[model samples]
Target: MEAPAYQRIAATFRGRIATGVLRPGDQLPTEHDLADQFGVARQTVRAGLGVLVGEGLIVARRPRGYFVREREHMVYRPQEKSRPRPAVPEMDRFSEQIAATGRTPSYSIEVALIEAGADLAERLRLDPSATVVARRRVRYINGEPTNINDSHFPIDLVRDSEIMLPAYLARGTDRVLAELGYAQHRAIDEIFVRMPTPDEVHRLGLGPGTPVAVHFDTGYTESGRPVQCAVNVLPGDRHRIVFERHWS
Candidate 1:
C-alpha cells in the first residue's frame, strides 16, 4: 500500500531538517505553498506539520508558521550529588557548574513553610501536615529560565538554620545541613520523564511539546534517618542526564 500524502510530506520535511536543508529558527513554507509543492490539500499539509510538532522537531509559532526547534543540552550527573562540593565560597553548586562552562548562572529563590505533601512526608518520614521548609529556586542560565530546584526539609532539622532564609547560602544548603548535624551519608536518585505541569512550563519557559525529567533525590543520615528530599525539575530539551561507572 502506498503511504498517505501527510506521511510523505512529513518525511520530506524531516529529511530536510536532518540534512540541514532546514536549520533551527528557519520557518517552513506557507501552508498554501507547501500544499502546492506537495500537490496536497492545505489541511493535509497542516496534518503533516503537526507530526513534527508532536515530535518536538518543530514548533508552531501561530500568526507565523512552524520552525525547526533549537536545542542545547547541559550535562547533569546524578552520581556527583553525594560528592563533596569544591571548597570555594560560591553561592551554589549549579552556579559553579555553569561558571565552569563559561556561562552565567542566576536564580530566583524563595523560602516557604509548607505542609508536607504525601510524597515528601513519606520521603522525610514526617507526619501529615508537618511543616517543612521549602527552599525553591528557579535556576537560570544567561538570563533564561532553565530548571527548577525545589528542596524540602523537615522543619525540625532546618528550623532556625540558614536553610530557612530565602537568600542564597554561600556554602549551599547541603553543607548547611551538615553543620546542623544532618549530614547526608547517602542518597537515592530517581528520574521520571513526563509532560511538564503548567507551573513547570511557565517556570522554565518551556515551549510546546517539551517534556521534563523530574529527579527525586532523597537523602539519609548514616543511621538511615531521612533528612532531605529534593525535587529537581529538568526540562528535557535543555538537559542530558549522565552516569559514569568503574567496574569493581
Candidate 2:
C-alpha cells in the first residue's frame, strides 16, 4: 500500500533539511502555503510539521510558525575487549558518548534505587525477589529530548559502589564497576523499533503516531557474569544505531 500523504510531505521536508536546502532556523512556509503547495489539507500539513517537531528537526512558536532546528550526528562504536574503554565519569555514559561526537549532552535522572522487582530479576538472572539497583534517565542532545534509559544492576554487586551515588559525588557506573572488580569485558545489544507507549509519548515529548527504537544492552565481566542490563529508547527520527563487525 502507498504511504500516507502526510508521511510523504514529512519525507520531502526531511530531504530538504538533509540536503541543506532548508538551513537551521529557517522558517517553514505557513500551513496554508504548505497545504496549497502539496495539494493537501491543512491538517495534513500540520501532521507533517508535527513529525518534524517530534524528530527535533524543527520548532514551532505561537504565532511565529515552524523553523528548522540544528541537527546533531551520533557515533556508535561496538563494545570491544581489545579496544580501550574509558572509565565512566560521574555522569550518564549515553550523554558522554554523545558529547564525544561533538554534540552537547544533557539528561535528567528520574529514579535511582536499590530495590527488588520482576524486571530486574529476569534481566539479572536472579530470583524474582532479588534486590537490585534500578535507574532511569532521559537524555537530550542540544535542547531536544532524544532517549530514555532504564538500567538495572544486582544490589550485592554495587550497593557500596560509586554508581549508586549522585553524579557529582561519584564516578559513573562503568568506572565504578571496574573498581568493584567486575570490569566489563564485553556486551550484547539488541535493537528493535516500535510505536511509543503512552508514558514514552509524554516522557520523550513525542507527538502522535511517532515510532521509537528500543535498545537492550547487557554488559558482562571477563568471567562471563552479567553485570548490567540497560533498556534505551531512542526516537526513530532523531537517532540511528550503527553496528560494525570486524572478524579476527
Candidate 3:
C-alpha cells in the first residue's frame, strides 16, 4: 500500500530540512501551494505541516506562514558545581564557561523571603511552612534567556547575608556560607525530565515539543546539615546535561 498523502508531504520537507535545502527562517510553501503540488486537500497539507510543528522542526506564523526552527544548544554539566571556580575573582563558574566559548553570560537576580514549599522544605530539612530565603536568577547568553536558577536557603542560615540581597555576589553563596560557619562539604543532585510548567514556558520562551529538565541540587555542611537547595530549570531544546563518573 502507498504511504498516506500527509506522510509523503511531511517527508519531503523533512528531507529538505535535513539536507539544509531549507534553512532556518525559510518559510515553507503555503498550504494551498503544497496542496496543489501534492494534488491533495488543504487539510492534508496542514496535517503534514502539523507533524513538523509538533517535532520542533518548524513553527507557524499566522499572518505569514511556517518557517524552519532555529536551535542553539548549550552544554550543562552538573558536576561543574563541585569543581573549584575560576582563579580569577571577576567571574563565576557560569560566566567562565560561557566566556571560554566566546559567549557573553549575564543574569538578573531577585531575592525574596518565601514560605518553604514541600519540595524545597524537604531538601532544606525545614518545616513546609517555614520561611526561607529564595534567591532566583535567570541566566542569559548573548542577551537571550538561557536557563533559570532559583536557590532556597534556610532563613536562619542566610538571613542578612548577601544571599538575601538581590545583587551579584562577587564571591558565590557557597563561600558566603563558608564564612558563616556552614560550609558545604557535599551536595546531592537530582534531575527530572518533564514538560515545562506554564510559568516556565513563559519564562524561557519555549515553543511546542520543547520539554525541560528540572534539576535539584541540595548542599550539606560537614556535619551533614542541609544548608541550601537550588532548583535549576533547563529547557530541553537548548541544553545538554552531562555527568561524568570515576572509579576508585
Q: What's the best-to-worst order under TM-score?
A: 1, 3, 2
RMSD of each: 2.0, 4.8, 2.4
lDDT by residue (1-248, candidate 3, tens digit) is: 98999999889999999999999889999998999999999999999999989888999999799999887778899788778775547878888789999988999999988999899888888899999999999999999889999998889998778788899887788888989999888999999999999999888888887889999999999899999999999998888888888998
Q: Note the residue pairs that clash in candidate 3.
A: none
- Candidate number with the higher lDDT (1 or 2): 1
Candidate 1 has its poorest 10 consecutive residues by lDDT at 84-93
> Which pairs, if any, clash in model 2?
89-172
* Clash count per candidate: 0, 1, 0
lDDT of 1 by residue, 166-238 (tens): 8977787888888899898999888899999998988888887799999999999999999899999999999
Note the Cα lDDT for every prediction shown.
0.89, 0.75, 0.90
For model 2, residues 51-133, the per-residue Cα lDDT tens digits are: 98877678787698988875444544435322554554444456566677787877676446655567556666888777777
lDDT of 2: 0.75
Model 1: lDDT of residue 131: 95
Residue 128 in model 2: shift from native, Å?
A: 3.3
* Error of model 1, residue 99, in angstroms: 1.9
**Of candidates 3 and 1, the better by lDDT:** 3
